[model samples]
Target: MSRRILLVTTLLLAGCTSGTPTPTPTPPPVKSGFKLVAFDSCEQLTKDLKAAAKKSVGPWGFSGGMMRTFGAVPDGARSAASAGGTADKAAPAFSGTNVHEVGVDEPDIVKTDGKRIVTITGGSLRVIDAASHKATGQLPLDAWGDADLLLSGDRALVLTHQGGGDVLYDRKMPMRPAGAELILVDLTGAPRVISRYRGEGRLVDARQTGDTARVVLTSQPRITFPDRPAARDDDEDRIKANQRVIDRTSVDAWLPSWTVTTGDTTEQGKVACNDVRRPVTYSGRSMLTVLTFPLSAPKLDSGRPVSIVADGDTVYGTPTSLYVASDQRWRLDFFPGRDNRTVPQETDVFRFDVTGSEPPVYRAAGKVPGFLINQYALSEWDGHLRVATTDSAQQSSAVRVLKPDGETLTQVGEVDGLGKNERIYSVRFIGPRAYVVTFRQTDPLYSLDLSNPAAPRVTGELKITGFSAHLQPVGPDRLVGVGQEATEEGRRQGTQVSLFDVSDPAAPRRLAQHHVKNGYSEAEYDPHAILWWPDTKLFAVPVNEGLLALTVTDNGLTEAGQIAPRASAMQVRRNLVIGGELWTLYENGLQISRLSTLEPVTYLRL
Candidate 1:
C-alpha cells in the first residue's frame, strides 16, 4: 500500500563508487508498547468474536465486489519485504543516486551489488555482471511459486504464494487460499536456494532493515457460511446459523498455520497463540501475521511469529517502525453508499517495532479520520509518526501527527481542510516536511512543516494542472514528481514529470514540467520502478513499451531518447546505472547502454 516495494542494481554497496564515505543508516528502534490478544482457548476465541460481531454497526465487506478489490488472498500483494541490507566487503556492490527512503528500503524486481545485477522475474532469478553486461547465472524461483526477492549482502529472500487452489474470496465452502513462502538464495556464484520458510496466508507485504526482514502474511478463517439461497424463506435462521459458526469457532481455527522447510525436513503447525492479538474493532474475517527473519541466516528463524487479528490490507514501514494500515473504503464502498453525511471512515493503523532483528514487536494501534492513499502517506520521524489521508466524509485531505504512548497512538495535531472537496493524490514525507498532492480539478501540491509534532501547519501551496503520484527529493529543497497530466476540468491526459523548487517552504514553485503524450508510467505508483542518477542528472521512467530517459536540470526536463522498446507487455521493468553504465531490466532480458549516448551497447536475454 505504501510505495514500499524493495531491491536494486549490483546493489551490494560496500564499495560504493560515489567517491564519498557515508555513515551507516541507523537501524529501527525495538519497542513493544501495547499488547494484542490471541486466544488461550477455543471458548475464549468464540466468546470474544461473538461480542465483536454483536456490536458491529455495519456489515464487513467479506466478499462480493469489495472482496475482488480488497479482500482477496492475493498472489500479487504490494508490500516491500526488503532486507535492511549492508554492503559486505565480499558482497556484490550496489548503489543508487538516492535511496528509496532514509529510514525504509523499498524493493525492486532487480537489484545489483555494483559488480553484478540480480533480478527476480517470471519465477526466475538472473544475475548479470556490471562490466560484462551479460547474464552470468540464472535460477528458477519455482520453489517459492513465483515470488519477489529481497537482497542483503549476498543473500536473497524469495517471497511467494503457494497452495490455495481456486478460492479467491467468498467464505462459503471452507478452503484456504494460497499461502506465503520465503526462500533464501546465496548469490556468490550461481543462484541456489539454501533454505525455505513456509507460512500460512497470502503475502500481504514485507519490509526489511539492514539484515532483517519483516514479512507480512494475511489469511482468513475458512468460513462455513452456507451458499446464498435463490429465494430465502427464513432470513433470521441463516443469520443465526452464521452467528453460531462464529460463536463455536476456536482461536486455532482463526489462526493461520505455517511451516518451516529446511532441506528435506519440515516442521508445521499453528504459531503460538500467546503471540497474537486483535484490535478494538475487528471483522474476525482476517488474521495478519508479521514474521521476521535474518537475510543472512541460512537456517529458518525459530522465533515465534507476532500475529494480529487485524483487517489490514495495506502496510508502510520506516527503518524504525513498520505500519500496517487498513482502509475502510470497503466500508464506504459497501454497506451505506457514499454521500455527504456518511460520517467519516477511519483507517486503523498498527505500529510494529522492527528495530530489533526479531519479528516486529507490537508497539501501538491508532485510527486516523480518513483512508490512506498509499504507503507514501506514512512516515516515522524523531519519536512520532505522521500520516496523510483523504477523508471523503469530511470532503477534505489532512495530515495527522501521532505519538505512540504505551498502547495508544494519540493524535498530537492535524492540518485538515486541504484540497477541499478533493482527495489526496500522493504524499511524500522528507524529514520535518511533508508534500501532499490532491486532485479533483486543479492539482494542488501542499507543503507542510512538521518540525513540531504538536502543531503541523501548511507553509506553502502550489496549484498545477496535474497530479503527482510519486515524489522524489533531488536536493535539500528540490523535488521531482511523477503522475498523470490532466486538463483544468480534471480530464487526465498522460504521464507528467515536474520539478519543484521548495527552498522556501513558504513559497514553493515549479521549476520545470514535462509531459509524455498518450502515455502512463508505473513509477507514478511504484517508486522503485524509477531509475535516477543524480551524478548525471538523468532519470528514467518506464512508459508503455519502453523507457523515457530525461536529463532533469534546474532549467527544465530534456528528453534524451526512448530506450529498449518492446512489443510485449513485459517491457522495461527497471532501469539502473551500475559502474557508470545504464542498464534496463525487462521480463525477458536486460539491456546495457552508454550512459552518455543512451545507445544500447549489449543485450542479455534471460
Candidate 2:
C-alpha cells in the first residue's frame, strides 16, 4: 500500500517566530509476510505453552470464577432480603400544575406525533398523551426481567438478561450458560410484542436499522474451577476461595447477534466472529460493529503492557465507517535469537470498513508514538467521515480528523493554553462544527470550525468554573453543558447548567448560567447524564441524589421542579425523555411526570 504525509505549521497566539518550521517524522513501514513460527526446541516450546497457560488462567481465576458462584442466576437470583426493600404502590398524586411525571427506570421518550410521546420504561413500551400527561396505553413484558432497552422510531428492542453475573475474582466455580432473548415491541399501534428471538450470550446493545434490530452479544467462555481450597481451616482461605469462584464465572456474557423483526416474524443471525466491542446503526439499512484482538502474543514472565491500554469503549458510526478509540500499548519484544523485532511498534489506530464482506477490515492508521487515542467521536458530513481523537498525553491534548480510508490522519487543532494536566472529556458534532468539553485542572467548552474538513480550526471557547459531565446541543447555534462545580478550596458547591451561543464559529460566548443548590451534603453531588428539550427549552439533569428539571429563558435557568427518589444514595437517570411528557428513572422502578403541570403522570408496575 502507498502512503502520504501532510505537515503544516501551527500558529500560536503567544507571538512566536512564524518562519521557522519543524520537520515531521516519517512513519515506519507496516510489516507483512512474517509467518507465525512454530517452536522447534524444547525450551521454545515450554516458553510458548507457559505464556498461553498464564493468559488462560489469569482471567479465569479473577473475573470468571466470581461470576459463576455468587452472581445473580438466569432466573434473577434473589438477593438476601434487605431491610429497605420497597414494594410497588398505586400511582402517586399529581400536584404541580406546570409539571407532571411520566415514566421511570431507563425511560427513552420520543415524540411519535405532535400530541403523543412514546417511551420505553422498565422493559415495556407505552404511549403517553401529551395534553393529558397520562399513559394512553402500554405493552408490558414481565417475562423478560431486568432487560436493557433501546428505541428507534416506533420500534423498541429489549435485551433480556442472560444467566448469572460472572465470578471475577473466584476460581472454584464452574462456568454457567449465559443467554438472552431479543424482543421487539411495536409502539405505533396498541403497543404489543411484534417478535422474539433467542441467543446464547447476554445482549450488550441493540441497533435498529429500518425493520431489523441488530443486537450485540459477547459469548461467555467456559471456565475451569479449582478442585481444592488454597488453604485449609482458615477464614482468609475460604474468602479467597469464594472470590476465586466468583471471578471465574461468566457474568453478563454476550455474543453478537442480529435479529430481523419484520411484520409478525423474527429471524436471528449470528456474527461470524466474537469479541464485539461497540455496535451502532450506520444509516437506515446497515449497522457498524467493532471487533478487537491483541496485536501481539502474551508474555508469560512479563506483566501486561501498559502503553497499549484499552481505556474508553464507545462505538461511533458515520454513514460509511465506524471509529473505535481503544487503549493500546507499544509492546517491545526483546527475545534472543528471534528476528530483530523493532518496526511497527504494535500501537496505533485500527480502522475497519462497515460494508466489507469480511466485516472488520482492520488497517493501521498511523504511528501515535508515545500516546494512545483514549476516546473518540465519529461524524459523517458531506460524504466525509470525521473522527475526533482524545490524546492520552496531558500536555499534548490534540484532535485529529482522519479520512475514511484510515491512511490519512490530519492534526487539525490542539486545545492549548490550559494546564498540562487538563483533559478533554467529550466531543460532539453539531452541524459543520465540533464542540468539545475539557476537564481536569480547567473546565471549558470549545467550538471548532470544520467547514474545511481536512483543516479544522478552533473558533471560540467559553471557560467555566465547573467541569461538564455531559453536553446536549439545543438548536443550530446554541448548546447546554451540564455538570457540578467545585470551589477553589476543593469543595463541591452545587450543580451547574450553562448555555453557550456559537453563532460565530471563532468566538463562542456564554449566554447564561444556572446554579442550583444540590440539597445533599457536599460529598453526594456526582452528575451522570443530561438531556435537553428543544420544544420546551428545558434541561433534565440526573445526579447522585435524583432528577432536576430546569427551564432556560432569556434571564437564565430556573429550577422548575425536583425529584428525590432516595437520600444520599446513587440514583442514576438510566435514561431521560422530554417530549410531550417528562420521565425519570430509579433502581426499583420509574416515575412519570407531566412537563406542563409538574404532577405525577402515573407510576406503572415494573
Candidate 3:
C-alpha cells in the first residue's frame, strides 16, 4: 500500500547528564538489545499475541501495523528492432530498469528487454513490440487493484492488491477488504496468466535476483470487530469489546492463509505455526511474511515461506541480505488524544539471509534510536549495515554503522549532530562515501566519508535554498537531484532539478538547476518514477502533469523536450527507452516517441 503512517515521537538516547563539563571516558560499544525468538508452539504464540493485544489494542483496532546492470541490456534480450527493422539498419541501444543495486532487480509497473515491453496497467497485462511500436498481445486481469511486475527471461511476476490502498483498521465492521496476489505470466507468445497465488495481506514490496523473486507482505489478524460506536458507547466499552474479540481469536487468525490456482487445480495452506518468529519487543497486532517464487516454474506454488510476528513498513534488499524495518511504536501512541511527541520512539530492523534458491533465513535483528525515512535510509556495505535516522523530538539526525555479531547487529560507530533542526529528506550511499540531504528552512547536503565504519565523519556541507528528495549518481563524480525548490522560510515553491559536481568530496557545488513553478513530481517520493539513461545522458522525471525530459549537457542539465502521453485518464507512471524510441506508460496504454526529436510515433490503447 502507498499510504504511510506518519511517526513522530520522542527519541530516548542514554548519555551523561548535562552539567559542568567534566572529562567523561568513552563508553564501550553497544550490542543489539533485541533478537527474534521463535514460539515454542502455536499455543504460546496465541497467548503472547493475546497478552499484547489486551495491553495495546485500541477501540478501532490494533493501531500500527502499520540494476542492476548499470544500463546493461537484460539477459536473453532480442534485437531492438528485430520485429520490423530493415535489413540495412542496426538495432538501437536500449536501457533497462533503474535499480539501486547492479544485480538485484526491483519490481515496477513496466519492464522491457529491448525488443518487447511488458507492462501491467488499466487492469490488464500488455506486451508491445519496440520495432512495430504496437501492442502485440494482451491479457485481461481479474478485479485486482493497482499492480506492478518483475520480468524474468520469458516470464513476468505481477503483484496486485485486492484493495487499492493500505489495509484500513477503523471502527468498521469486517475491516476494509484487503488481500494480495502474485500472478505469473508466460511471455513466450501472448501474455497469459500461468499461475495465480492469492493471499490475505497487503503487498509490502519485492526484490528479484535472477529468476527468484521474494515478496514481502503484512497482515492483521482476521478477527471481525464491531462497527462504529453507538451514541452511548465510549472508548472504554469499545476497547473491552475488541479485547473480547482477541480472546476468542485462534492462532490461525494471525497466520497468513493463501491459495494457489494453477490451471483450475487450486490448493490452500497457511504459514506453519512452527515457522513463525518474533522480536523480543513487538505489538503482535500484525505479522510480516516473505514468500519465495521461481518465475521459471510452469505452475506457481504457495512459495516456500517464512513468517514473523511483527509489522514492517520498509523492505530493503540486496543480492544477499533483506532488511525489514518497523517503527517501534509505544503501546498507547495510537490511543485517542495521546500525544505521540512524548512517546519514546525507536526502530527495529530484522535482517534475513536471502542467498541461494531457498527461502530467506532470519539472520539477526537490531534497534536504533529513531525511525527511518524509507528504504533509502539504509545501505548494506562490506558486511556492515549503515543507517540514517531523524529524531523528531530532538530535531536532529545521525548516521550509524552496525555489523552482524553472532545473532545481533552490534553498533560499532556513529556520527551525530547533523542538520540541527531538520530531518533527512534524501540519502544515497556510494561505496565508501554517503550523501545526505536534510532541510527545514534550508537544505544542508552533507557528504560523509564512511571509509572508516567506526569513525564516519562529514567531509563537507552545502547549504542550499532547495532540497532534493531523490539523488541519482552521475559518472561517479556528479549527482542529479530531483525535488522541489523552496523559499528561505522552508516553503516549497515548485519542482526543481539540480546538477552537482561532487568530484571534490570536501567542496561539492551545484553546477546548474532547473525549476518548474508550482510543480511536483512523484520522483520525490519514489525513485522508480525517475529514469537516467547514462548512454545518451537522458534524465526524465514526471513533473506536474507530464514527463519532464532533460539531457545532461557538458556543464548542466538542458531541457531536451517533454512527452505528454495521450492517455489522459491515467498519470504517467514510468518511462523507458527501447531502440531509438521513448516509451511512456500510463494506466490506459503506452505512448512511443522518437528519443532524438521527441516526435510522436504511435499510441497503443490497451
**TM-score of every candidate:** 0.85, 0.58, 0.89
Q: How far out, in Å, is residue 428 in model 1?
A: 1.2
Taken over the whole model, the C-alpha lDDT of each candidate is 0.67, 0.40, 0.75
Q: Tell me the number of clashing residue pairs for each predicted model.
A: 38, 75, 2
- lDDT string for model 3 (436-504, tens) is 888777788888888888778788888889899888886768888888899987789999999988888
Number of the candidate with higher lDDT, 2 or 3? 3
- Model 1 weakest lDDT span, ten residues long: 8-17
State the lDDT at 323 in candidate 1.
84
Candidate No. with top TM-score: 3
Better of 1 and 2 by TM-score: 1
Candidate 2 local lDDT, 249-355, one digit each (tens) = 33221123445444555555544322222211100111123322111111011111111112222233332343333222211122233223233312234443444
